[model samples]
Target: MTSLPMSDYYFRQFEHDGADAPAGRKGRIFSAICQGDAPTRKKLATDMALRPATVSDLVMELIHDGLITESRPAQSLQKGRPEILLTPAPGRLCAVIFHFVSHTMHCAVVDLAGTILFETTEQVQADKIDKQGFIDVLSSLAGKCTAHIPGSAKQCGYALSLPGIVDEPGKRWVYSAYWPKLSDFDLSEVSETLGHDVIVRKNLNCELRARTSRRKSLGTGKTLLIHWGIGIGAAFISNDRELVLTEGFGEIGHCVLDPLSTVSCKCGMIGCMEAEAGLWALATMSQDQSIPINEQKFEDYLQDCTDKSFLKRPLLLMAHTLRNLTLTLMPDEIVLTGPFVQCPETFQRLTERFELIFPEGALVRKGRKPKIVSGRRSKSDELVGAAFDLFRTEIGALCRI
Candidate 1:
């Protein structure tokens, strides 16, 4: 039998003990609790090398703060003491998520457990609104939703998901042709308007990638997601569980797919992916061909379209785009998400073509064949991710306090 290394065994034991330790105890306790079953105060104290009294005090504080709850003691037949488990109390906390798209915005109030309590959407010409005007609108809506919560002003936070480049840490949107004036504006203003104590802003695609990668339905080992909406972009998760967010990454839509193609993109580029497979491209193509379609009408007609010529052109262009994305990322699985998934046939045709092009060997050596699937929770994913972002930030504040 091979003996485990002493360092490994000690580290494992330390992790187990850290679960119920005092505040000064290493962060290992929190890490273990997040990944493993709840531990008793005694076990946590032992692992953290702290006194039982200290563990008790810390656990009580956490419970009182609404961060966790102590459950009923475990059933035991023996005459010994029983152990109570700790679990997160999702209801005591809440978060607000705003998914800002080119033509509309989706807003939701979600709990810590990722449940969407209420949701609202509005259609507006995003390009026409200035920085403060957009913030005012978002703030007004958030105020209305949060008012429904009964409390002494619940701790609130906002998550902004947008399509253009964002300075994540700086909380500034560098550029987004969809809303030009939004560039160089303090995003915290939205939080002020909503009366939220905390605010977070992230690139829409990057936030989507983080949310999808964590979903169990998508199957958790390194995956990639490509969203085709007003723009086309890709997000990647590495095998080591690292989220790679490059400066201005996943701007494939701006890349010239065909310089000869006549379509012009909002980025002022001709024949780019945004000019081809993007929703605008598809909408333009349909309209130019004299197909009677509007945003709402297109959704209805897309399901019953019988003309192969009309369907074939867009599907082929989408397939080509997917092929290019696959060749570049070689993701374990490629999930097609976003507004486009609403059209089931369009999604199905794209998947069929992807499979046909790379029958085998794609993501094969990486332990699984890359599979293409549609976004399961279209609106839910964004809202949940936004909520989690808020919850996580709050947790950090509590730790500091």
Candidate 2:
């Protein structure tokens, strides 16, 4: 750690939107190593367009700060001296990530290199845990994960990957259709109790940011990610490798599909897309039949249902919504996440219906048609995304050391 603790720098960065450019020479080099764009000092100089001496100076400073380590490769084909490779130090500059999925909390201690040092999951009944209970568990988990951070590493801060609307600037969880009881909760003071700054963000944004790294394989064109879970939402990345709509951009769930329908959305709207097609709404429907609201169990129920028509309305609604979005966005690929899309039969039916509605015809041109695919959410991806997001955004502070 430098004169100022990394945790304090993280707090300041979390509160302020700093420059988009990676900080100075030191920051650029560190960012390069973190992104795996440069593994050796020679590569770093070439990539950053900096001289070898400047790169060496910055790399030496990084090594002295314990933010990075240099190691020589075992095999060298045509070299008098072995090439030294640069990698992020495993025990330095770590963060604690809390991912709040439906009825569960997934916590992990992740290093700056996108490695999960430790992780744990806890389940809670929706009716049981209140704001205090949630905070207690979060603080406890923070402590547990903090204990796992190696002594030499500086624990930067805590990141909450929550569901629903997050007042990021305020660090407040404004609302969630599923976790209604915890709505309008204040998160500013959470840092006080945990003894570290806490940054709050919507879960989809974190997942989308992590998934966007695969844009090269997915396509250089636009890639859209739609999550049809407890709440239906979407995230998009453009051809320039920029995330579009940082907050509340692709909130398809709140779009009113019917003005006269009595089905109420937890967002306080009637006939919203989520009211009809979101898993939460489906859970309510299942509860009417005395069925529990577990995602896996709900998928099993959908698979075993006798009357398949029960899914027709929701599927049609989602398909039509996606069809219009496809036409509007004209993305190269649409990645679907959450339970509905995770279930093979449901995903097949939904995509088939989407194809039927927006076939590559005179209206949508052949090349303009987007490929619809299923996306699975891994806990590791979420943790890495959150940790990397922190480091990437405030990399200047990390390099300042």
- TM for every model, in the order presented, reads 0.75, 0.84
Error of 2 at 50 (Å): 4.5
Per-residue CA lDDT of model 2 for 1-401, tens digit only, reads 11111222223332233433334557656656755733899988877677899889889988988878888776778558877888866567788999976788878988765678898878886556789998888988887888888889887788998877776667888777767788898998999999987888777766776666644465457878888877788777674544455555677888875677789878777888888877778768753564445666766666666666667888998998888788788888888987777778889999989878877675555557788899887666567666754665545565653
- lDDT string, candidate 1, 1-401, tens digits: 11111112112333433344444243344333444466667787777677878668777776777656677565766576677776545566777677865467777777655566777777777768887677767876677767665472244577776666566566667666567667666675555566665445445444554455455453446566666665667666653433555456667667765668888776666787777766666767765464332334555555566653555655676777677766777676777765556688678877887677656665643433567777643555566545554555555555432
- Worst 10-residue lDDT window for candidate 1 reads 1-10
Backbone clash tally (model 2) = 0
What is the TM-score of candidate 1? 0.75
Model 2 root mean square deviation, Cα atoms: 5.5
